[model samples]
Target: MTAGVLSPRARPRLGFLGVGWIGRNRLEAVARSGQAELVAVSDPAEVAARAAAEAAGGCAVLPDLDALLEAGLDGLVVATPSAAHAEQAIRALRRGVAVFCQKPLARDAAEAARVVAAAREADRLLGVDLSYRFVRGVPELRRLVQAGELGRIYAVELAFHNAYGPDKPWFYDARLSGGGCVMDLAIHLVDLALWTLGFPAVRHVESRLFAGGAPARGRSGPVEDYAAATLTLDGGAAVRLACSWKLPAGQDCVIEAAFYGTGGGAALRNVGGSFFDFTVDRFRGTARERLAGPPDAWGGRAAVGWAAALAEGARFDPAVEGVVAVHEALDRIYGA
Candidate 1:
């Protein structure tokens, strides 16, 4: 879809950058939503960019960010590797272009803060693809907790384990991908817990990092494949997190989040170790309540939400400050 096909006010011209599998997937999501008009695509890989552009149904293919920016885009979707996220997002926001980028937004809180500042100055919407927030039952769970329906959540436990590791080598480099499976995977768990609880300041953080089965020794050494951390929040609540990659875990993946409250407790967990399927449950003593189940098409929700908001002329959302908070917590876990 292009601006010419819709009323002038109805479509927002968007650009896609780094059209890898994830990027292309989000592109398809936005396109299918019919909320935004995709105008151009850019990627360093010629074959990948061409394929993505073609799949976008005749959207123009630009060779680089400069060309894409010059195409008069209303927003940019960034799916580049971790190292380039902060710089690319800053540039797009400074150019008055809204951005929806993959998670980490940056390697640390400092970089994330800079990107958020750029969005604030430009008065443009900035979003990070912390896609788990869009998962089934999460929003409902968050609402219940926030509304005091769950009543004074005292403790939370979150976990994400993958039997397979990343396909890229940079994922093992601390300078490039930030940290190991923690940043690439567990960051989602950390973000989900803090965000679910309204982002109370983490008063204390203690962590253990491991490579294979051994503990991490030095900061400059290789990244850890396994990690566990405990967070003590200022609101008198505590959170525990555990995540890993290629963990000899019997399942393809294991994901779960549970919150314990004075009055009741709620939990969400994947079914059959499938990355895409999950079920949410609420508990009263030994009795249980099922709130949600599988077949939830949620992976595309973040991209679609950004596209819909952009179409509505949404400005910078202060909720993006939560992105900064999530990054800060990860920084503490990494001892950065």
Candidate 2:
């Protein structure tokens, strides 16, 4: 095994798994950071893995996680199937490797909790792709809420509607995806609401699921096309979230999260239905103020943050325990 490329400043040696678009995008961010060395990559698609390896300027292409782990990596970045995340990440963590995985880190609450527990037991860093938390403007919004600038945060309304559905077949398979748009999209909203509010306990939750434009049944397993849920938090604060795939929303997508407080309110809304552009604003009585607008490249922020944290020798963050809560809330929504 090569001497792992821990940065001169204590950066970690990193490996990329499943180098598809999302995976490569994160690789690019990690490369730009100079915080870690890209040592190995693994993907079932030879062409995709080769492309990603080329992007890394001759990084090794390992055949599987076992091979990748043998390279002596400090961490792994997983952008694989939803059904695979928990198992893969657990395996890596068991080997004392940190992990940064795309959202829904597991098929459901139990699986997600197990992954978190593995990291906790291994004394390693673990992160999910809840990328929206790293939005440049959102931190400021959170600061405002913390400072009471938003007064008492009484309610939150979040939405994520995509006109385009997943091209992958696994997305529609209940057992594979865990759930449809809810797990894939609304997870971001749930993470956003809880993180912003300091992760309050969910007091109650009610949800509706649909598939093929009709109410879902127990046999749906993990299949769901649309999901809408209302959660009441411990403080009596309320959160409303709706997410759907292939909606006739007249735009490519509609994404927004708004917070309402006793004193004022604020929201981050997408522009031109573009997934990549967003505007944040503060609203009062009758006037609106902008907090942040487009030109913000935020997608890879979460992965980059994880890479940076791994570089610093971060252990399991107490915040990771929040993943447990998030999943518990998700379970409630699914009536599991």
Candidate 3:
């Protein structure tokens, strides 16, 4: 149902499907936005679920996804493990519930497509938390590229290196977490590159995967700790990406997305190795102009945006098509 046609309640009832740290953060964001009413929460861990319920001022602590679905929610916020994203989102959508999920959306393109199809059939809103696009300067950077202020963009560079890897066992398993650093960190890079350039067709992709500094040619074993890939877009712009976990970077993290064109250049870079702080700049010859910078509470924006849209009675957005396309490139990166 579209807005003003079958308007949702003034405050759409939402359910938290996973109450982990990321999940709770998004929950608070949506709640604080005053766009939706959180009515229920579900997680495998009772402690986490109870903690989130208390944080939400005593929303019902449900048992699982089924119970949450039964709580009459207009939307479901999914923050579960990577492998469970597709199944959980599809199930929720088919129940006529909107879904806001943490990305990869699914492990591969095929799974992502199925989830999107379910949303289409149900005519329900579907959103993925690809939060980097909400970073302060990213929108300005995108505007510069799309507006052709950067001229004919030629090469793009992306990188994300975490000095410390994941602390969870599931993250090390390719089967469970999809891939390692690429899935965890580079997904943002890919999303940023494609998004900044308006989701152009990916013409070609070349990749190198490594685990413990050794070549990792397949996903059958442990996930890669390091990955490098170059993608040729529809118009021949080259986008190169490198991301890793636990590398000796002498800092907490290193992240950047830089674009060079005939007329000028632009970039979004982390400041002081801080994941939460970023600065964007545009360059023309020897002169560089600042675009935007830090202290942005962007991590929860993707989810909160979806909540606001759902409360406005938005449904079945075709923009989700681009998210499925994102997986197509990710699959190619993994040789899937």
Candidate 4:
């Protein structure tokens, strides 16, 4: 949560390793931020690679990771499928290139640890676009909670229910996606809650996962379309999380988090089930105060922030360890 999304320091040369929609969108965000130079892009699909390159005002469109690394990039943005995130990020790091990857970081905690270890070994900057942290009201909530304004927070309720989920085939395959709604949507809730609460230790985790209206027996089996989990953090705080995809949710999405503490309570809720509009409210007795509201351009701030930090010569941030922590909690939720 800096003043500007992009750094004002020297612009770093960057490459996009996967130019699918998310990849291309982040590329455009960085390009628009003017914090980095787009050197090259590579994707297995020629259409996507070329489209992303064109979107960057015609950067070099290469064939693969090798060509991208050979472009002399100072940084790489990995937006491939979930299964590819860890390996691609590791390869980029080993090449001495900084990396900002899309979420899940890896399918599970072990894979995530490997990527983080690689980044530490290479002494490079590693970032993941967990995106929610950049949301306008979210950072403010984090500030309040960490500042002890929300004294002794005892409970957190978070949810993300998407009316229409991923349209990709890989998402339905647990091996490819890691998990369903939980992996795709609930991950944000988990990250936001932990990050806001300053990453407390999870004393225990319990959960129920369902896919196709049946229990998801194992992580390696069916992909969960609905999930509800409870995380008991140190200090006896209970974090409740629920997420689903293609549910009869009556709206586009339901994304919200409510925090209750001894001193006060606050909540961040979406407006009209719109993904982009959100409001944060503080509650004292029966009264409420608005902390933040819509018209905030936060969608791409995570990607932009990473690039900006790179321009400022940031390297090997220890905060990347939080990524590992998030995935570890995910593992426990899946009964690991």
What ranges in model 4 sit over 4 Å off? 1-8
- Report the lDDT tens digits of candidate 4 across residue range 209-289: 988889896586878889989999999999999999989989999999999999898898999989889999988889999
What is the lDDT, from 0 to 100, of the residue 196 in candidate 2? Answer: 87
Instruction: Mark the regions of model 3 whose C-alpha exceeds 4 Å error after superposition.
Output: 1-9
Give a tens-digit lDDT track for model 1, residues 1-336.
111222334788899999998999999999898888889999989899889888888899998888878888888999999999999998888888889999889988899999999999988889889998898888988988888888899999989999999999888888898889888998888888888898889899998988978887424588888889898999789898999999878989999899999989998899999999989888899999988888998888999998888887788899999988888888888782
- Cα displacement (angstroms), candidate 1, residue 281, comes to 1.4
Which candidate model has the greater lDDT, 1 or 2?
1
lDDT of 3: 0.89
Best by TM-score: 3
Estimate the TM-score of every prediction.
Answer: 0.96, 0.96, 0.97, 0.96
Which window of ten consecutive residues has the lowest lDDT sum in model 2? 1-10
* Candidate with more favorable, higher TM-score: 2 or 3: 3
Cα displacement (Å) at residue 140, model 4? 1.2
Taking the tens digit of each residue's C-alpha lDDT, what string does model 2 give over 75-148? 99999988999999999988878899988898888999899999999888899998888776899888888888
Q: Which scores greater on lDDT, model 1 or model 4?
A: 4
Give per-residue CA lDDT, model 3, range 231-324, as digits (tens): 9999999999999999999999999999999889999999999989999999999998988887788888888889888878898999888988
Q: Rate the local accuracy (lDDT) of all candidates.
A: 0.87, 0.87, 0.89, 0.88
Candidate 1 residues lying further than 4 Å off, grouped into runs, are 1-9, 217-219
